[model samples]
Target: MNESLNELLYRSFDTTLSDEEQQRLDEGLKQSEGLRQEYDRLKTMRRIMAEQPQPDFMPGFADRVLQRLEDGGDASGDAQLFFEALWLSFRRMGTVALLLLIAAISYNIGSSDNVSLRSAFNIPETTMEEIIEPDFYQELESLR
Candidate 1:
Protein backbone atom coordinates (compact mmCIF):
# COMPACT_ATOMS: atom_id res chain seq x y z
CA MET A 1 0.00 0.00 0.00
CA ASN A 2 2.93 2.35 0.82
CA GLU A 3 6.67 2.44 0.09
CA SER A 4 7.62 2.06 3.79
CA LEU A 5 5.36 -1.03 4.13
CA ASN A 6 6.72 -2.53 0.91
CA GLU A 7 10.32 -1.95 2.09
CA LEU A 8 9.50 -3.56 5.42
CA LEU A 9 7.94 -6.57 3.68
CA TYR A 10 10.99 -7.07 1.43
CA ARG A 11 13.33 -6.58 4.42
CA SER A 12 11.35 -9.17 6.34
CA PHE A 13 11.97 -11.76 3.57
CA ASP A 14 15.66 -10.83 3.74
CA THR A 15 15.53 -11.20 7.56
CA THR A 16 16.66 -7.62 7.91
CA LEU A 17 13.46 -5.89 9.10
CA SER A 18 13.71 -3.86 12.33
CA ASP A 19 11.16 -4.47 15.14
CA GLU A 20 9.41 -1.14 14.37
CA GLU A 21 9.30 -1.89 10.58
CA GLN A 22 7.91 -5.36 11.26
CA GLN A 23 5.19 -3.90 13.49
CA ARG A 24 4.26 -1.36 10.83
CA LEU A 25 4.21 -4.04 8.06
CA ASP A 26 2.05 -6.33 10.26
CA GLU A 27 -0.43 -3.52 10.98
CA GLY A 28 -0.55 -2.61 7.20
CA LEU A 29 -1.16 -6.27 6.16
CA LYS A 30 -3.90 -6.58 8.77
CA GLN A 31 -5.64 -3.40 7.58
CA SER A 32 -5.30 -3.97 3.76
CA GLU A 33 -6.02 -7.18 1.87
CA GLY A 34 -3.99 -5.84 -1.10
CA LEU A 35 -0.93 -5.46 1.12
CA ARG A 36 -1.31 -9.02 2.42
CA GLN A 37 -1.65 -10.46 -1.11
CA GLU A 38 1.38 -8.48 -2.38
CA TYR A 39 3.40 -9.59 0.63
CA ASP A 40 2.54 -13.25 -0.04
CA ARG A 41 3.51 -12.88 -3.72
CA LEU A 42 6.86 -11.25 -2.86
CA LYS A 43 7.60 -13.90 -0.18
CA THR A 44 6.86 -16.70 -2.68
CA MET A 45 9.07 -15.04 -5.30
CA ARG A 46 11.95 -14.68 -2.81
CA ARG A 47 11.62 -18.36 -1.81
CA ILE A 48 11.55 -19.48 -5.47
CA MET A 49 14.64 -17.40 -6.23
CA ALA A 50 16.46 -18.84 -3.23
CA GLU A 51 15.60 -22.37 -4.35
CA GLN A 52 17.02 -21.86 -7.89
CA PRO A 53 20.71 -22.25 -8.73
CA GLN A 54 22.72 -19.09 -9.42
CA PRO A 55 23.77 -18.28 -12.98
CA ASP A 56 27.39 -18.81 -14.13
CA PHE A 57 29.05 -17.02 -17.09
CA MET A 58 31.79 -18.46 -19.30
CA PRO A 59 35.27 -17.06 -18.68
CA GLY A 60 36.70 -14.41 -21.12
CA PHE A 61 33.28 -12.83 -21.72
CA ALA A 62 34.84 -9.35 -21.78
CA ASP A 63 37.66 -10.54 -24.02
CA ARG A 64 35.18 -11.99 -26.52
CA VAL A 65 33.25 -8.70 -26.65
CA LEU A 66 36.49 -6.76 -27.25
CA GLN A 67 37.47 -9.20 -30.00
CA ARG A 68 34.11 -8.70 -31.73
CA LEU A 69 34.54 -4.89 -31.58
CA GLU A 70 38.03 -5.18 -33.07
CA ASP A 71 36.70 -7.36 -35.90
CA GLY A 72 33.88 -4.87 -36.57
CA GLY A 73 36.41 -2.00 -36.84
CA ASP A 74 37.81 -3.54 -40.06
CA ALA A 75 34.30 -3.78 -41.51
CA SER A 76 33.72 -0.08 -40.82
CA GLY A 77 36.87 0.80 -42.77
CA ASP A 78 35.71 -1.36 -45.70
CA ALA A 79 32.29 0.34 -45.64
CA GLN A 80 33.96 3.79 -45.75
CA LEU A 81 36.08 2.72 -48.74
CA PHE A 82 32.97 1.36 -50.51
CA PHE A 83 31.08 4.67 -50.01
CA GLU A 84 34.09 6.70 -51.19
CA ALA A 85 34.37 4.62 -54.39
CA LEU A 86 30.61 4.99 -55.00
CA TRP A 87 30.87 8.80 -54.58
CA LEU A 88 33.85 9.00 -56.94
CA SER A 89 31.99 6.94 -59.54
CA PHE A 90 28.99 9.24 -59.30
CA ARG A 91 31.20 12.32 -59.70
CA ARG A 92 32.85 10.88 -62.81
CA MET A 93 29.47 9.96 -64.28
CA GLY A 94 28.18 13.51 -63.59
CA THR A 95 31.20 15.04 -65.35
CA VAL A 96 30.80 12.73 -68.36
CA ALA A 97 27.05 13.46 -68.58
CA LEU A 98 27.70 17.23 -68.45
CA LEU A 99 30.28 16.94 -71.23
CA LEU A 100 27.91 14.87 -73.41
CA LEU A 101 25.12 17.42 -72.87
CA ILE A 102 27.40 20.27 -73.87
CA ALA A 103 28.56 18.35 -76.98
CA ALA A 104 24.97 17.61 -78.01
CA ILE A 105 23.99 21.30 -77.64
CA SER A 106 27.05 22.44 -79.63
CA TYR A 107 26.35 19.93 -82.42
CA ASN A 108 22.71 21.02 -82.64
CA ILE A 109 23.66 24.71 -82.81
CA GLY A 110 26.38 24.14 -85.44
CA SER A 111 24.28 21.83 -87.67
CA SER A 112 21.28 24.21 -87.88
CA ASP A 113 21.04 25.74 -91.40
CA ASN A 114 18.13 28.18 -90.91
CA VAL A 115 19.08 30.21 -87.83
CA SER A 116 22.43 30.53 -86.05
CA LEU A 117 22.56 30.62 -82.19
CA ARG A 118 23.55 34.32 -82.22
CA SER A 119 20.78 35.32 -84.66
CA ALA A 120 18.16 33.33 -82.76
CA PHE A 121 18.87 35.36 -79.60
CA ASN A 122 19.72 38.67 -81.28
CA ILE A 123 17.44 41.78 -81.06
CA PRO A 124 15.28 42.48 -84.18
CA GLU A 125 16.96 44.80 -86.72
CA THR A 126 15.49 48.42 -86.83
CA THR A 127 14.37 49.90 -90.21
CA MET A 128 15.24 53.47 -91.29
CA GLU A 129 11.49 54.36 -91.25
CA GLU A 130 11.15 53.21 -87.61
CA ILE A 131 14.33 55.09 -86.57
CA ILE A 132 13.31 58.30 -88.35
CA GLU A 133 9.60 58.22 -87.41
CA PRO A 134 8.06 61.74 -87.31
CA ASP A 135 6.15 60.86 -84.10
CA PHE A 136 9.47 60.04 -82.31
CA TYR A 137 10.93 63.43 -83.27
CA GLN A 138 7.73 65.14 -82.13
CA GLU A 139 7.94 63.40 -78.73
CA LEU A 140 11.61 64.38 -78.35
CA GLU A 141 10.87 68.02 -79.26
CA SER A 142 8.01 68.07 -76.72
CA LEU A 143 10.31 66.73 -74.01
CA ARG A 144 12.90 69.44 -74.75
Candidate 2:
Protein backbone atom coordinates (compact mmCIF):
# COMPACT_ATOMS: atom_id res chain seq x y z
CA MET A 1 0.00 0.00 0.00
CA ASN A 2 3.11 2.22 0.24
CA GLU A 3 4.17 4.27 -2.84
CA SER A 4 7.36 2.20 -3.57
CA LEU A 5 5.87 -1.08 -2.30
CA ASN A 6 4.36 -2.26 -5.60
CA GLU A 7 7.58 -1.55 -7.56
CA LEU A 8 9.69 -3.41 -5.02
CA LEU A 9 7.17 -6.27 -5.00
CA TYR A 10 7.30 -6.77 -8.83
CA ARG A 11 11.07 -6.31 -8.96
CA SER A 12 11.54 -9.10 -6.40
CA PHE A 13 10.05 -11.64 -8.87
CA ASP A 14 12.58 -10.95 -11.63
CA THR A 15 15.68 -9.74 -9.84
CA THR A 16 18.02 -10.68 -6.99
CA LEU A 17 17.04 -8.12 -4.35
CA SER A 18 19.90 -6.31 -2.62
CA ASP A 19 19.98 -6.35 1.17
CA GLU A 20 18.33 -2.88 1.37
CA GLU A 21 15.72 -3.64 -1.37
CA GLN A 22 14.92 -7.02 0.18
CA GLN A 23 14.39 -5.37 3.57
CA ARG A 24 12.07 -2.74 2.08
CA LEU A 25 10.05 -5.37 0.17
CA ASP A 26 9.76 -7.62 3.23
CA GLU A 27 8.44 -4.66 5.24
CA GLY A 28 5.89 -3.92 2.44
CA LEU A 29 4.79 -7.58 2.25
CA LYS A 30 4.20 -7.67 6.02
CA GLN A 31 1.88 -4.59 5.80
CA SER A 32 -0.19 -5.69 2.70
CA GLU A 33 -2.23 -8.92 2.35
CA GLY A 34 -2.97 -8.28 -1.38
CA LEU A 35 0.76 -8.04 -2.14
CA ARG A 36 1.36 -11.49 -0.70
CA GLN A 37 -1.42 -13.01 -2.84
CA GLU A 38 -0.03 -11.42 -6.01
CA TYR A 39 3.45 -12.81 -5.29
CA ASP A 40 1.95 -16.30 -4.83
CA ARG A 41 -0.05 -16.02 -8.06
CA LEU A 42 2.99 -15.03 -10.14
CA LYS A 43 5.08 -17.84 -8.63
CA THR A 44 2.39 -20.45 -9.33
CA MET A 45 1.94 -19.19 -12.93
CA ARG A 46 5.67 -19.43 -13.63
CA ARG A 47 5.79 -23.00 -12.30
CA ILE A 48 2.78 -24.04 -14.40
CA MET A 49 4.31 -22.52 -17.55
CA ALA A 50 7.66 -24.21 -16.89
CA GLU A 51 5.99 -27.63 -16.69
CA GLN A 52 4.25 -27.24 -20.10
CA PRO A 53 5.96 -28.46 -23.25
CA GLN A 54 7.32 -25.95 -25.80
CA PRO A 55 5.37 -25.41 -29.06
CA ASP A 56 6.49 -25.53 -32.70
CA PHE A 57 5.35 -24.08 -36.06
CA MET A 58 5.71 -24.86 -39.79
CA PRO A 59 8.83 -23.51 -41.56
CA GLY A 60 8.97 -19.91 -42.84
CA PHE A 61 6.23 -18.95 -40.40
CA ALA A 62 8.16 -15.92 -39.13
CA ASP A 63 9.04 -14.73 -42.64
CA ARG A 64 5.41 -14.75 -43.73
CA VAL A 65 4.47 -12.80 -40.64
CA LEU A 66 7.11 -10.15 -41.40
CA GLN A 67 6.15 -10.07 -45.10
CA ARG A 68 2.54 -9.39 -44.20
CA LEU A 69 3.64 -6.61 -41.85
CA GLU A 70 5.96 -5.15 -44.55
CA ASP A 71 3.00 -4.99 -46.97
CA GLY A 72 1.57 -2.38 -44.52
CA GLY A 73 -1.72 -3.78 -43.16
CA ASP A 74 -3.00 -6.78 -41.29
CA ALA A 75 -4.77 -9.53 -43.28
CA SER A 76 -7.15 -12.21 -42.04
CA GLY A 77 -8.80 -15.47 -43.19
CA ASP A 78 -8.31 -16.16 -46.93
CA ALA A 79 -5.83 -13.32 -47.44
CA GLN A 80 -3.68 -14.53 -44.54
CA LEU A 81 -3.64 -18.07 -45.91
CA PHE A 82 -2.67 -16.83 -49.39
CA PHE A 83 0.26 -14.73 -48.08
CA GLU A 84 1.56 -17.60 -45.93
CA ALA A 85 1.44 -19.96 -48.89
CA LEU A 86 3.38 -17.46 -51.01
CA TRP A 87 6.17 -17.12 -48.41
CA LEU A 88 6.40 -20.90 -47.95
CA SER A 89 6.94 -21.39 -51.68
CA PHE A 90 9.70 -18.71 -51.85
CA ARG A 91 12.43 -21.35 -51.37
CA ARG A 92 11.22 -23.12 -54.52
CA MET A 93 11.62 -19.86 -56.46
CA GLY A 94 15.38 -20.07 -55.89
CA THR A 95 15.35 -23.61 -57.25
CA VAL A 96 13.41 -22.43 -60.26
CA ALA A 97 15.99 -19.70 -60.92
CA LEU A 98 18.87 -22.20 -60.60
CA LEU A 99 17.21 -24.56 -63.08
CA LEU A 100 16.85 -21.70 -65.58
CA LEU A 101 20.55 -20.88 -65.19
CA ILE A 102 21.49 -24.51 -65.85
CA ALA A 103 19.19 -24.63 -68.86
CA ALA A 104 20.79 -21.49 -70.32
CA ILE A 105 24.28 -22.94 -69.82
CA SER A 106 23.18 -26.20 -71.45
CA TYR A 107 21.71 -24.34 -74.40
CA ASN A 108 24.86 -22.28 -74.77
CA ILE A 109 27.04 -25.41 -74.77
CA GLY A 110 24.75 -27.43 -77.02
CA SER A 111 24.73 -24.76 -79.72
CA SER A 112 28.49 -25.10 -80.45
CA ASP A 113 30.84 -28.04 -81.05
CA ASN A 114 33.85 -26.18 -79.60
CA VAL A 115 32.41 -26.37 -76.02
CA SER A 116 34.47 -23.40 -74.79
CA LEU A 117 32.66 -20.67 -72.85
CA ARG A 118 32.95 -18.08 -75.61
CA SER A 119 31.78 -20.57 -78.28
CA ALA A 120 28.97 -21.77 -75.96
CA PHE A 121 27.70 -18.15 -75.75
CA ASN A 122 28.28 -17.73 -79.52
CA ILE A 123 30.84 -14.92 -79.29
CA PRO A 124 33.02 -15.04 -82.39
CA GLU A 125 36.76 -14.32 -82.67
CA THR A 126 37.29 -11.17 -84.75
CA THR A 127 40.08 -8.96 -86.13
CA MET A 128 40.33 -5.15 -86.17
CA GLU A 129 40.03 -5.38 -90.00
CA GLU A 130 36.82 -7.44 -89.71
CA ILE A 131 35.34 -4.92 -87.27
CA ILE A 132 36.52 -1.99 -89.44
CA GLU A 133 34.71 -3.34 -92.53
CA PRO A 134 31.49 -1.29 -92.32
CA ASP A 135 30.60 -1.89 -96.03
CA PHE A 136 31.75 -5.55 -96.26
CA TYR A 137 32.96 -8.32 -93.91
CA GLN A 138 36.49 -9.78 -94.44
CA GLU A 139 34.72 -12.96 -95.62
CA LEU A 140 31.26 -13.50 -97.27
CA GLU A 141 30.64 -16.57 -95.01
CA SER A 142 31.04 -14.25 -91.97
CA LEU A 143 27.47 -13.08 -92.72
CA ARG A 144 26.21 -16.45 -91.60
Candidate 3:
Protein backbone atom coordinates (compact mmCIF):
# COMPACT_ATOMS: atom_id res chain seq x y z
CA MET A 1 0.00 0.00 0.00
CA ASN A 2 1.15 3.52 -0.67
CA GLU A 3 1.99 5.52 2.48
CA SER A 4 0.40 8.91 3.36
CA LEU A 5 2.63 12.00 3.07
CA ASN A 6 3.05 12.31 6.90
CA GLU A 7 3.78 8.57 7.28
CA LEU A 8 6.28 8.74 4.42
CA LEU A 9 8.06 11.68 6.12
CA TYR A 10 8.09 9.88 9.52
CA ARG A 11 9.54 6.71 7.92
CA SER A 12 12.08 8.79 6.06
CA PHE A 13 13.66 9.95 9.36
CA ASP A 14 13.64 6.93 11.82
CA THR A 15 13.73 4.10 9.26
CA THR A 16 15.44 3.18 5.96
CA LEU A 17 13.28 3.55 2.82
CA SER A 18 13.11 1.04 -0.03
CA ASP A 19 15.47 1.80 -2.94
CA GLU A 20 12.52 2.57 -5.25
CA GLU A 21 10.97 5.06 -2.82
CA GLN A 22 14.37 6.64 -2.06
CA GLN A 23 15.00 7.24 -5.80
CA ARG A 24 11.51 8.67 -6.18
CA LEU A 25 11.98 11.07 -3.22
CA ASP A 26 15.39 12.13 -4.58
CA GLU A 27 13.85 12.96 -7.98
CA GLY A 28 11.02 14.94 -6.29
CA LEU A 29 13.51 16.80 -4.04
CA LYS A 30 15.61 17.73 -7.11
CA GLN A 31 12.46 19.04 -8.84
CA SER A 32 11.55 21.26 -5.77
CA GLU A 33 14.71 22.56 -4.05
CA GLY A 34 12.59 25.03 -1.98
CA LEU A 35 10.66 22.11 -0.34
CA ARG A 36 13.94 20.45 0.67
CA GLN A 37 15.25 23.72 2.20
CA GLU A 38 11.98 24.31 4.12
CA TYR A 39 12.02 20.70 5.41
CA ASP A 40 15.62 21.18 6.68
CA ARG A 41 14.66 24.49 8.43
CA LEU A 42 11.61 22.87 10.15
CA LYS A 43 13.72 19.90 11.29
CA THR A 44 16.38 22.21 12.78
CA MET A 45 13.72 24.40 14.54
CA ARG A 46 12.04 21.31 16.05
CA ARG A 47 15.35 20.03 17.39
CA ILE A 48 16.28 23.42 18.89
CA MET A 49 12.81 23.82 20.52
CA ALA A 50 13.04 20.32 22.06
CA GLU A 51 16.46 21.11 23.54
CA GLN A 52 15.50 24.57 24.99
CA PRO A 53 15.78 24.97 28.81
CA GLN A 54 12.91 26.06 31.11
CA PRO A 55 13.09 29.41 32.92
CA ASP A 56 13.97 29.49 36.64
CA PHE A 57 11.52 30.98 39.21
CA MET A 58 12.00 32.87 42.49
CA PRO A 59 13.15 30.57 45.37
CA GLY A 60 10.16 31.41 47.64
CA PHE A 61 7.36 30.43 45.24
CA ALA A 62 6.88 26.95 46.72
CA ASP A 63 7.16 28.22 50.30
CA ARG A 64 4.55 30.93 49.72
CA VAL A 65 2.19 28.35 48.18
CA LEU A 66 2.55 26.04 51.19
CA GLN A 67 1.99 28.98 53.58
CA ARG A 68 -1.23 29.82 51.74
CA LEU A 69 -2.43 26.21 52.12
CA GLU A 70 -1.83 26.34 55.89
CA ASP A 71 -3.99 29.51 55.95
CA GLY A 72 -7.09 27.66 54.56
CA GLY A 73 -7.35 28.24 50.80
CA ASP A 74 -10.55 27.44 48.80
CA ALA A 75 -11.27 24.62 46.29
CA SER A 76 -8.75 25.97 43.80
CA GLY A 77 -6.20 25.81 46.69
CA ASP A 78 -4.78 29.25 45.92
CA ALA A 79 -5.84 32.94 46.50
CA GLN A 80 -8.40 31.69 49.07
CA LEU A 81 -6.92 33.55 52.00
CA PHE A 82 -6.79 36.90 50.19
CA PHE A 83 -10.26 36.49 48.71
CA GLU A 84 -11.82 35.45 52.04
CA ALA A 85 -10.33 38.43 53.83
CA LEU A 86 -11.59 40.83 51.16
CA TRP A 87 -15.07 39.23 51.18
CA LEU A 88 -15.40 39.46 54.96
CA SER A 89 -14.39 43.14 54.99
CA PHE A 90 -16.91 43.95 52.25
CA ARG A 91 -19.73 42.01 53.96
CA ARG A 92 -19.25 43.79 57.26
CA MET A 93 -19.14 47.22 55.57
CA GLY A 94 -22.19 46.42 53.44
CA THR A 95 -24.24 45.48 56.53
CA VAL A 96 -23.20 48.69 58.26
CA ALA A 97 -24.08 50.77 55.19
CA LEU A 98 -27.58 49.21 54.96
CA LEU A 99 -28.18 49.81 58.67
CA LEU A 100 -27.18 53.48 58.36
CA LEU A 101 -29.44 53.97 55.36
CA ILE A 102 -32.43 52.43 57.21
CA ALA A 103 -31.81 54.64 60.26
CA ALA A 104 -31.52 57.81 58.16
CA ILE A 105 -34.75 57.13 56.24
CA SER A 106 -36.65 56.29 59.42
CA TYR A 107 -35.53 59.50 61.13
CA ASN A 108 -36.30 61.74 58.14
CA ILE A 109 -39.75 60.26 57.41
CA GLY A 110 -40.77 60.29 61.09
CA SER A 111 -39.78 63.97 61.58
CA SER A 112 -40.80 65.48 58.23
CA ASP A 113 -44.13 67.48 57.95
CA ASN A 114 -46.57 66.93 55.07
CA VAL A 115 -49.03 69.82 54.38
CA SER A 116 -51.57 67.45 52.83
CA LEU A 117 -51.77 65.57 56.13
CA ARG A 118 -51.96 68.76 58.28
CA SER A 119 -54.81 71.17 59.29
CA ALA A 120 -53.36 73.70 56.80
CA PHE A 121 -54.85 71.54 54.04
CA ASN A 122 -58.31 73.00 55.14
CA ILE A 123 -59.14 69.86 57.20
CA PRO A 124 -60.68 70.65 60.64
CA GLU A 125 -58.79 70.00 63.94
CA THR A 126 -61.16 67.13 64.78
CA THR A 127 -60.39 65.46 61.44
CA MET A 128 -56.65 66.04 61.97
CA GLU A 129 -56.92 64.54 65.51
CA GLU A 130 -58.76 61.47 64.14
CA ILE A 131 -56.14 61.11 61.37
CA ILE A 132 -53.32 61.19 63.95
CA GLU A 133 -54.85 58.72 66.47
CA PRO A 134 -56.38 55.24 66.06
CA ASP A 135 -58.24 55.53 69.43
CA PHE A 136 -60.04 58.65 68.11
CA TYR A 137 -60.96 56.74 64.94
CA GLN A 138 -62.37 53.87 67.04
CA GLU A 139 -64.46 56.29 69.12
CA LEU A 140 -65.85 57.99 65.98
CA GLU A 141 -66.72 54.57 64.50
CA SER A 142 -68.60 53.54 67.68
CA LEU A 143 -70.53 56.89 67.75
CA ARG A 144 -71.50 56.43 64.13
**Best candidate, lDDT-wise?**
2
Query: For model 3, how does the per-residue alpha-carbon lDDT over 7-113 read when each residue is reduced to its tens digit?
Result: 45556776899998777666656666665765587689779988999987899998978886886745454476778888999999999999987676666556656
Model 3's C-alpha root-mean-square deviation from the true structure amounts to 11.3
TM-score of each candidate structure, all chains considered together: 0.35, 0.37, 0.37
Candidate ordering by lDDT (highest first): 2, 1, 3
Which regions of candidate 1 fall more than 4 Å away from where they truly are?
Answer: 53-144
Candidate 3's C-alpha runs over 4 A off are: 1-27, 73-144
- Determine the backbone clash count of candidate 2: 0
lDDT of model number 2 = 0.81
Root-mean-square deviation of Cα positions for candidate 2 versus the true structure, in angstroms = 17.0
Structure candidate 3, residue pairs in collision: none
Model 3, residue 24: C-alpha shift (Å): 6.0
